[model samples]
Target: MYPILFSFGSIHFYSYGLMIAIGILVAYYLAEKKIKANGIDPKRLEWLVFSILAGGFAGSKILYWITRIPDIGTDPTIFTNLGDGWVVYGGIIGGLVAGWFYCQNHGMNFWKTFDMVIPEVALAQGFGRIGCFLAGCCYGVETHAWYAVVFPEESLAPAGISLFPSQLVMSAYDFGLYFFLEWFSKKKKFNGEVGAAYLIAYSFGRFVIEFFRGDMIRGVVNGLSTSQYIAIATFIAGIAIIVIGRKRFSQSNK
Candidate 1:
């Protein structure tokens, strides 16, 4: 794995940060195209995307800290060490919440906006996982499989051990999900259906992938990782959104 892509005389360019920036730009391009097609004011896209990113970052960091409460109690400096640790679920939730508020404030249709944005979120996540793989974070358990990867000494993962490539798997899944959701959005019966589908699909996929994860910073409870528990709740919420949305749509038509 290559954490530092390159170093200029006194400055180092990090692969993780680079990939994240790439993801954001790509996602924004796609989202802007979609919003313009859907009759949304393209001018609003910047502030909307900014709000979601800001909220997602805050939420991810806050959840990471929450999971490390015991460690934080032992050493409070962890709170100020902002460069490491993030939770994807927290980012998803926070981004959605922030997007909802933005939509409401701007008199935009929240569900329609959510449907348009979620696919790009998946696309961004796919790229982010690539960053995780390059940085050797969110690595998988040791394995002797043909596809196993070994990080370099400088990477975050343990060096000299062949481990399952969970990050790549997750990245592939996210990319696939992005394609599927993009297609599904066209055929969705209700405004929130696409977003709900994203929630359901991503939660199930994440829950399964968590078993392959080797990192312990994410926390474990009752034989399952914290993410798995959140996945269950997110799955349920997705189902509820679909059911309620359909019901409301039917009632309005009636």
Candidate 2:
């Protein structure tokens, strides 16, 4: 489905890569605006973003490799083939860890920064899902629904079969979540509320979406996809954060 966006004299630009780049830029611009409005040091934005991105990339790749461990015995290229395979959950965790460390090192308030940035992360994910759709990755199960899509021969999805279009669905969910997070942030009683809400909402959404997913490359454990397990844990973690954060806020106020 038009994976190659354009070609320039023997060089081709892929739709997936292009869309991700656009997503990063858009997210970064929005984050800058948010940081400035919140009185954060605008200069710290560059390094903070860089650290999160680097950590996210590494985490995604590492998780992908872990899932492919079974394939490694059959295909030695599984570890070296860095062109594809990444776990979104891994990226989320990794980015947060990196951001936390960066904030600690730079004397920034981690929860405050995360609350401001998490909505942008969802926005970026919305664009990234568009990339996944264009590349025909993260495809949905075959369906006879009227809204099903059919990928061409060049696409990664099974060619010419009507499918559920899960990528677009996820994209829409991400976009909607971004707006909801933004609204929640405004009404939040504590610094970590928005970020915690994000984890809960996104994890639950992902857990449900996994049922629609056709690709099983991400591994399954005990009748559930790898992400489903992670989603459960993430959801619990989110709840824990909210409880702890609210308690801390209450204590501080008293």
RMSD, each candidate, Å? 1.1, 1.1
What are the TM-scores, per candidate, against the unseen true structure? Answer: 0.97, 0.97
lDDT minimum window of 10 residues, candidate 1 = 75-84
| Prediction-by-prediction clash tally | 0, 0
lDDT tens string, model 1, 1-254? Answer: 99999999979888999889999999999999998998888889999999999989988988888888989878898788866688999899888889899999999999989999899999999999999999999999999999999999999999999999999999999999999999999899899999999999999999999999999777899889989999999999999999999999899999
Candidate 1 stretches greater than 4 Å from native: none
Q: How many backbone clashes does candidate 2 have?
A: 0
Clashing pairs in 1: none
